[model samples]
Target: MTEEPLPTNASSGVVRVGDTVRRPAGPWTDSVDALLAHLHAVGFHAAPRPLGRDEQGRQVLQFLSGEAGSPDPRWSTTDLGAVGRLLREFHDAAADFTPPPDAVWQTAIPADREDLVVHHDPAPWNLVRRPAGWALIDWDAAGPGSRLWDLAYAAQTAVPLRADRPLAPTLPRLRAVVDGYGLDDAGRAALVPMLHRRVTAMVELLRSGAANGRRPWARIWTEDGPYWQRTADHLAAHTDDWAAALG
Candidate 1:
């Protein structure tokens, strides 16, 4: 069961092997491996099993079998229900797993915070869609963080609706995601403040990167800064709207 001849991209450092994918280790690689091992020990099987490093010193793992969504129109129109279900499964699987002692926090801006085992960057490409539902990948950023962190992060990455569609259609998408996660009223209500903070930090990161002479990275942040700002503005302007949706 070798991997299919899929083209590699900049965002993922995946290399193919017979029925497995080998990823070169980085600063956080050892921590990710330990975390994945712990997860398997505790019976969470959705994540890849750490098979060990390859001859090239790349970290190897069992390849997940599923269809990957291309960044095409069809993928953009993915049903909200599927997204919700996938998130719920992830949260459920991730629940009750204590963070490893050396688990390094990687998601969001570098901040001093409490430790909780969290999947920091649970974006689309980091997810694999199987018939049963979705499974996550790229555990590099998984560490101690709040469940809201994952939720808010997902909301920010979701595809926006076309101009002709009702404005803020992504709001409904957000709701569907929450409903899928089955968060209680209190948890949902708390999301308003966090939204602004998250978006603000993202904008800052991108802007700083641009100013630091990382031209390509800087351009990405500069381009995306406005979107993050708009989302923050929307959340600020419509606190009540956000509350209603969360409720």
Candidate 2:
């Protein structure tokens, strides 16, 4: 297919050409492309492979066909577990990837500590549910971050640690995911507290994006920020309950 716009994405204007995706080039694209190539060289199969640049000078990536998640997803327990396991694989595989010299990323904030190159934003929305397994997309936000923190962000967004959604229903799946990820007691204890911090940063990002007139983030800020603020509060309040369950 000639480069035609794909179905609307929440974040950016991306296009599809034949079996590849063409995205706008950014300052950090070189770093991202190098990282993906490294992941491939290191034998991580779930991430996209970078093809040569298209005629439009856009970055092209191999199109991985599968399902992406939405705000309100009805994922099966098996799907949740699979996502968890897949995330663990990605983290392990990416543990040693070295980015290009003088690399930079679209980081919201510098990681507290660089454990490895993390898909810093692995929320359900950026994941593709493939028959082979879950594949994480959108490396735009990927960068150096703590492994546990990355997984915690993913779990919180996927399990969606929140107040309106009943704790009993979400907790079991949360535990299942943590178990599937093979997280140790220490990781489990830290997950909830980290989630609280992640969501707080996310809320700030939303508000800031709104202030600056960015897409989706602006809309999300107006429409959903309050609910998520409440969710952050809930996570902070129930850290003990979560730790007891997962720890």
lDDT of 1 by residue, 88-168 (tens): 666666676666566555454552243456676666667678876667777766766667777766655543322223446
- Per-candidate local distance difference test: 0.65, 0.82
Q: The CA-based lDDT of model 2 is what? A: 0.82
**Per-model TM values vs. the true structure:** 0.79, 0.92
For model 2, the superposed segments whose C-alpha errors exceed 4 Å read 7-10, 212-216
Tell me each candidate's RMSD, in Å, in order. Answer: 3.7, 1.8
- Alpha carbon lDDT at 47, candidate 1: 85
In angstroms, the error of model 1 at 30 is 1.8
Candidate 1's displacement at residue 184, Å, is: 0.7
Positional deviation of residue 152's Cα in model 2 after best superposition, in angstroms: 1.4
Candidate 1 yields a Cα-based lDDT of 0.65
